[model samples]
Target: MSNLKQELKENIIELLNLEEFSVEDINDNDALFGDGLGLDSIDALELMVMLDKDYGIKLTDPKEGKEIFQSIAVLAEYIEKNRTK
Candidate 1:
């Protein structure tokens, strides 16, 4: 799980093109949107693609992404459980 979390941070930085953020800049529990990382809906769509392309996890419902993407920890957990790649 910890390893997954670290991978998630790295993936997020790369996938989101967050040049200003390093893996250390993201906390396990930090919110990824709004007042946290300040990501918008477009970022969310990018993340959905990241999940599918990298993890082989497909989220058909955007609403499901809300809970899974609340933080790196949660996202990592979800991926660890569901990732096919």
Candidate 2:
């Protein structure tokens, strides 16, 4: 699970071009948007693509994406349970 969280941090930084942040800067409970990581809607869309392409988990509902993107811990858990890859 920790590995998943670390992987997520790396992927997010690379995918979003967040050069200002490092893996240590993000905590497990840190929110991925708004005041947390300061990600915007565009970043969320990129993450959805990542989920589908890397994990084989496609998100059809925006609301569901909102819930899953709450934090690294939550997202890692979801992937652990649902990832096909």
Candidate 3:
């Protein structure tokens, strides 16, 4: 779980081009979308693709992602359980 959160921090920094944040800046419970990081629906789509490409967890329905991606904790748990790789 820690490793997944760490990786998420790295990926978010890179993927979002967040030039100001370090991995330590992100809290595990911090919301990845909305006011927390200012991410939107498009960002969610990008993240969904990222999860599919990097983790091999294809999210066929975006609605399913809502619960699975509420926060980094949930995302990591979902990935750990469903990841093909």
Highest TM-score against the true fold, candidate: 2
lDDT string, candidate 3, 56-85, tens digits: 988989799877767888888888899997
Better of 1 and 3 by lDDT: 1
Could you tell me every candidate's TM-score relative to the true structure? 0.94, 0.98, 0.90
| Model 2 segments more than 4 A misplaced | none
Between candidates 2 and 3, the one scoring higher on lDDT is 2
What tens digits encode model 1's per-residue C-alpha lDDT throughout 1-85? 8888888888888888899999888899999998889888999999999999999999999899999989988898899899999
CA lDDT scores, all candidates in order: 0.91, 0.97, 0.84
Which 10-residue window in model 2 sums to the lowest lDDT?
34-43
Model 1: C-alpha RMSD to truth? 0.9
Q: Which 10 successive residues of model 1 have the least lDDT summed?
A: 7-16
lDDT of 2: 0.97
Model 2: how far residue 84 lies from native, Å: 0.4
